[model samples]
Target: MKRRDILKLAALAGASAVVPGVLSEVRAGPIGHTGPYWITIQAGWGWDPTLFCDPKGAPVNATYDKAQIAKAGNIPYAPSNENDAFFGKYASRLCVVNGIELSTHQIEAAFRQMWTGALEPGYPSLAALLAAGLGGGAPMPLISAGGFEETAGLVPRTRLVGAQPLDWASLTAPSADMASLFSPMTETRIAQYRRERLKAKLATSLPPGIKSVIEAAEAAELSRPKLEQWKAHWPSPLSDDPSRALIQLTLAAFKAKLSVSANLWWMLDPAVTDAAQVENFNDWTARFDVLMDEIEAFGLDNSVILVASSGGGRTPMYLDEQMKGHWSVGSMLLLGPGIPGNRIIGGTDENLRGLPLDPSTLEPNPTGVRLRPAHIHRALRRLAGIEASAEAKAFPLDAEDLPLFS
Candidate 1:
């Protein structure tokens, strides 16, 4: 028999000895429930909030109505008015917060399609959120589509709310060892591998520099005296394709009850090579819509929360010559369990200045001003069942924000 066949036998023998107990352990306990899942999308660049949710013609709106509109043409697009109609489908389980202000630099691009009511297809924010909230046990996993410099910081924020961060690449492409060893293939390979013990021994040496905790865990499993036991504990089979492997890994993580949150950030900054074009925003949004449908297919809607937001607004660099140095606020949409959906929460000035409106009332704050990102974060954490006292002492904004939580 081939060396592969020999190792397979040894692995199978080891697994048969442990499979029943391990399987029982998995099924015996109650799956830990970590409240709801929450997600926040940061439109890195300035996202024009006005295009999606505008204030009912206040001073800022008046100025834009008289000058900016004539210059920019029908400031609000067709989709802005349909917030209630579209989100209402998931009303009791969703909350749409508009007029969120993000402090960031603006590169040159005019007209904000990033958050202009049109969806970019295949964006993963909503899908990931839904998966986590509905998945039991550990906090929902957050997955990001595009890499970001601030991901480390953003991840901890979710953790504070009791959700875990699902590594995007790993989810898409699970480790080969995790699959080959634990899958049913192990049973088939058991008798074959035992006949070639020498080859199996030679192949088992781990490579250098593999020090991750997960790697260590795998190494420990591989060292088991009974190969069958180790095989039974290995992860399920994985695909050779990286992307397909990731999806499988994500599903496995969910099935294993290991993660509850995932996030995918689609680059919207014009400065980035991969930024979506204005004409393609609709197509992109549609892709995201389809992705959500796929998540629903997983039957995780009841426990998950879907959130969509822009890194920031963009100004089309190809547009009008005179328009320069202007920035727009980003937009956010929420849909999921326990959310109050089918409603727009805040308003924006025609110039995209976010107004300070009560989240419940949707009326302007008499105190005068706009809502800040910090407040938005506070509200979201609340939705996730993270008490204000549990928030990190380190404030994303001013140290004063700590007081708000206290």
Candidate 2:
């Protein structure tokens, strides 16, 4: 098989293994992830950095003056009074990466590029890479509450959100009503017989394509038991807010050892055009703080790497519509155990254009490279210790490795 075909088959097998109805007699307990947990929060509809982290004055951002920029440690944030609480509380743990240059300003392409590190379609998302590599035997692996769900068929994406309760029993059960179905022991025996027949059938010579499908079926049978363990960790009453619901689900999964990475979406009010827009962003950050608080409460703070990135950025200069247009430059915030805190890496000029940086020192250099999503993904793979994994290799982000998390 060609390399791409092999990858596709492997991805297909992985995707198949997560299906809810795989039948097996073995009762394997839930597998937990003891390593670093990754959580990526993507801010939808383009976010304006000048309204939050990267501050400007007068013509750039008419709302805030350059002199009004607030300092929290080494990082300087927007002048919005509400931002003080967020920056002040988490600045010590936050590694702000500014001036990320996106190749395209189109929303769909920007979202794909920002999270997957590939401008073209078909690459697995960063969350997928983390799950495929570091997730180990996590049943759900990567729980994508919202935003990019592209997995390149590498792994299955599960959406466990909101106050709704999951019907775990129904997923694996033989029938809707137990009274009308075969007994549990009898059903288990029937499943075991079916698996044995499939195994015997696979023992005979077969075409590569058919053989791969059978192998995937066998893998799914082996993985069926893990799904039963999720019920113990499901939250009692989930939050109504989509973002908060994602956080709660991810944390519970982390605690249950059911997941490794999660992708979350930040849906800000796109209608707000004035100063309240800044507050809207500020309020979201405050909610982000609550995520950290709960992580700490669960004693998983040290093991979690938190990321909040924008799909794209709004222009520094206002357009004729009295609102900022899409800009090529973007920003990201990383926090957790290994990342250097209270530091700002990369930057932009007054016009919100990305600056070239010396990859080695991460300092501005006239003859250096501008930061891009690929560079960030490369660093992230290193952080997750998955740079050399087959999944990462399948979807390479050919960029110089900077010490982003060190």
Per TM-score, the best of the predicted structures is 2
**Clashing residue pairs, candidate 2?**
32-257
Expressed as tens digits, the lDDT of each residue in 113-215 for candidate 2 is 9999889999988888898888635566777766787878676566644333333444344233453477778778877986897799799999988786676
Tell me model 1's lDDT, rounded to 2 decimals. Answer: 0.38
lDDT of 1 by residue, 53-127 (tens): 342323432213333321112122223223333332334444556665655443222112232111222222222
What's the CA RMSD of model 1 in angstroms? 12.2
Best by lDDT: 2
Q: Once model 2 is optimally superposed onto the true structure by TM-score, how far is the C-alpha of residue 45 displaced, in angstroms?
A: 1.1
TM-score of each: 0.52, 0.83
Query: Least accurate stretch of 10 residues (summed lDDT) in model 1?
Result: 20-29
For each candidate in the order shown, give its overall lDDT on alpha carbons. Answer: 0.38, 0.73
Measured by TM-score, how close is model 1 to the native structure?
0.52
